[model samples]
Target: MTQATMTQTKVDNGVNVQALIGAREALEATPAAAQFKWRATCQWVNGTHSRSTVNSFFGLGEEQERPRSFTVDADHPEVFAAEDNAPTPAEIALTGLASCLMGGVASVAQHRGIQLYSVRATVEGDMDLQGILGIDDEVRNGFGTIRVTFNVDADASQEEIRALVAQAQKRSAVFDCMTNPTNVVVDVA
Candidate 1:
């Protein structure tokens, strides 16, 4: 489904949130690990209340202010990685993976009429010095991909349970690396 379709729906009680996320998981998962990439727009302010916008959730709830914290890249549209104590880009990526796998499995379980009592995912990544410092060309940068260890509680044989999880991941838009491959269109906004 298109990204617009995903955002068109709103949640008054927040129950429809999962359906919303699942609907646009494909497109939403395309952008970097920004909190929200519905083309978030923020104006600069030297004083308090730095950025404000009508789009997305920014400039709305909480009456918050943009702290001095921010990161800018010469390429791609500028992103608000965090205000002050914002989670690092790497950290956000890990969270996305967890959400994708766990949510995907849950959705599938619903279809199979299986009661998943507990589901947990732990993810880890390694950043080589060269990748971190942007010094080594031979060594690929970023997460070099990631690994996930899923601990699940269910009533199925090991093979059956594993197959179900794998199937869910396949349908998951966020988990499909090749399907929702990220495109870094950078040029600073």
Candidate 2:
């Protein structure tokens, strides 16, 4: 096929397939390029309220800057005896998971030559505040169960849609992080 034909076919589902493939190939050639260190700094605003800022990150073997700084505010609800300023940390976690999975679905669908018309997702995390409140020593501080449902509209069969969502879950970094345990060290600096 001609370059134009290939390019045309690669531009699907609002994703630049050619650019994505090129990035993968380049990263494969230089494995170190895939290593990234994402960083965010949080400062306390008041009781049970804090703000986190994101500006730049280390990726592609170098420091990369974003177009502008982004900030996220976290606070508890009135029922929790705190100001209802913004979403809680737990809600933020759910948002991160949903965003990552949706992004994966788009990319995977594009790679498989599928044209996606629309995709919507609902993510739920079941948490027991007993652990966080130190009311029950046996309870866990994190979510006990997390569920995600996707409603996808595309030029593909139901089986294909299911497979697409499954593949996206398999490839999602946030999904893996939530399901698996990682080393976390905390100290005063």
Candidate 3:
């Protein structure tokens, strides 16, 4: 059977029963060793256009893995004097944030035995390009503020869902990464 068909068949009460069970088992077995490192490579195409490729899932104990290769393109809008071929980097960052939050929501809901009907997250970031353009030295080139709204339909009380969302935010790696400062070293090759 196809993957979609299998998924549909394995779903129970709006949750993927088999997948959740498997994930729980994996987590239980791995526990403290369940850490993972994700890597992506991006190459500049030309004039505010670039492509990124994601393929591998690396972890502490997994010795053999299949390559799941996919590519995404990023480009600036026409107003920026570039072709609007794909979403800008800032847009992609928001996408990543939304996706990570959604994943957290789903996982937490499943663990709490809450059946999710639908979950959606809207993420917005405010930024000023003056810093990037060297027009304003005091302006930062990154997002000045970001807001996220999550709309979830589930078989659970509003208070429960709110608590779940708070827990998810506390546990979400992307959320922590965005909010907390990290040490980054840049080396020119």
Candidate 4:
């Protein structure tokens, strides 16, 4: 096959593998270009309800803006003595984790030339409210455990699917952030 034909055949699972490879090569060539800064602003709407907006970020050595602004509302449930405005912060964290892992799975599958028919992820997090309520100092303010189960239909063996998920976990930034300690600074201006 010609070089062009070989390159054209690299597309899989709706991802252009050649482009992915090209991006990696470009980042490797300029290591500083790989640095990215994500930003989000949150505004309090009412009791335990707030909206966070994501419209721009710093990436690839320059400032970048999204094609459209996006906002997410977070609030406590009715049981927490607040309006059920939207998903809770913990739920949003779960969503981020699931999305990050799923994206990794798709990217890995595409690069590996695996044809994916469907992918579904179920994420569950167990947390105790005692810590947040100051009822139990021993309990953590975050999830005690988080579990992710993926149901993927692809043209690959069971072992390959497991390997794909394992690789996704290994490469997932959200997984690393949640599993490891990150320095966070909070101050009122």
Candidate 5:
């Protein structure tokens, strides 16, 4: 849904003082908040140990040196959940839009040499079941349109920011794709 209707995804809302204290006690075993990284181990399709052609990885959170391991292929470019179940490619498309915007905006800022601190983006798109479910042949299917509401948290003037966005549009290929469709040639390989 768009921001007009976007609400927070539900997370644990429970609050228990004793539980909190116990959790704090458990955390006390650690050095401090500013001194940790998390890691995760991931295993992808096929195998590992130099015999696997699998394209998966692992990572750790801030407390660890790396993330959990997972597999990747044409199916998942961002890998998967450390638990072996991350988001699919489509979820990543949205990420692509945001990332494209971020890169574009940042490039514009940097090319212009603006000392901006942070850039944030809110991306939204809608898809009908017919498109993804392959029920309707008439529907365009994949994201009729994706709207990006950029909330650039930088100390720049509105005029400069607007100019930056304009520059970003001038440079962002994905933005061009959405604004301008890319022609394709179909062939059976």
Candidate 6:
């Protein structure tokens, strides 16, 4: 891929400059109503497999319907008595983290007037399945640790890019959600 020209600051590097400006303006105009809520529904398909659909999300002022349907599948491996058709839930979670961070990087870079040629992130989580299988009470059911590595190519110094990533992480909702405790309620109908 070609390197981004430093002189061509007017070009948007995959991020929508106009949309970002508009969103910032809207938020500044109404800080109290800037909260956004996203929703998705999931249904069981079979053993260790499920599908989620995202159709609408509420934000800014009202509920907005999606222009197209978005679907995701979650499934375990065949070794776990699953069809191995789709990615496991843990894998999907990692994907979500990576995607969110990438978005943050792009948005932050754009806002800072930096032109980026490429940005990539690799995320890995260490998990012990013994807890989920009830084979070991000492083991945790989720990831014990998660690691992320970012490779960014931009017309900026390494220190500047590092600062950009740090700022992005601070602004990423997914990163906050993963690091902070969230209350979850489960009920059977």
lDDT of 3 by residue, 109-168 (tens): 766667678888889999999998999999999999999998888777788789879888
Better of 3 and 5 by lDDT: 3
TM match of model 2 to true structure: 0.92
Please, what are the lDDT tens digits per residue for candidate 2 over residues 19-87?
A: 989999999999999999998999999999999999999999999999999999999999999999999
lDDT value for model 6: 0.86
- Cα deviation at 3, candidate 4, in Å, is 23
Q: Which candidate model has the greater lDDT, 2 or 3?
A: 2
lDDT: which candidate is best? 4
lDDT: the better of candidates 2 and 4: 4
Clashing pairs for model 3 are: none
Worst 10 residues of 2 by lDDT: 1-10
lDDT of 4: 0.90
Give one digit per residue, the lDDT tens place, for model 6 in 22-46. Answer: 9889899998668888899999998
lDDT of 1: 0.56
* Poorest lDDT segment (10 consecutive residues) of candidate 4: 1-10
Could you tell me how far off, in angstroms, the CA of residue 90 lies in candidate 5 after the best superposition?
2.3
**Which of the predicted structures, 4 or 6, would earn the higher lDDT when compared with the native?**
4
TM-score of each: 0.55, 0.92, 0.82, 0.92, 0.53, 0.90
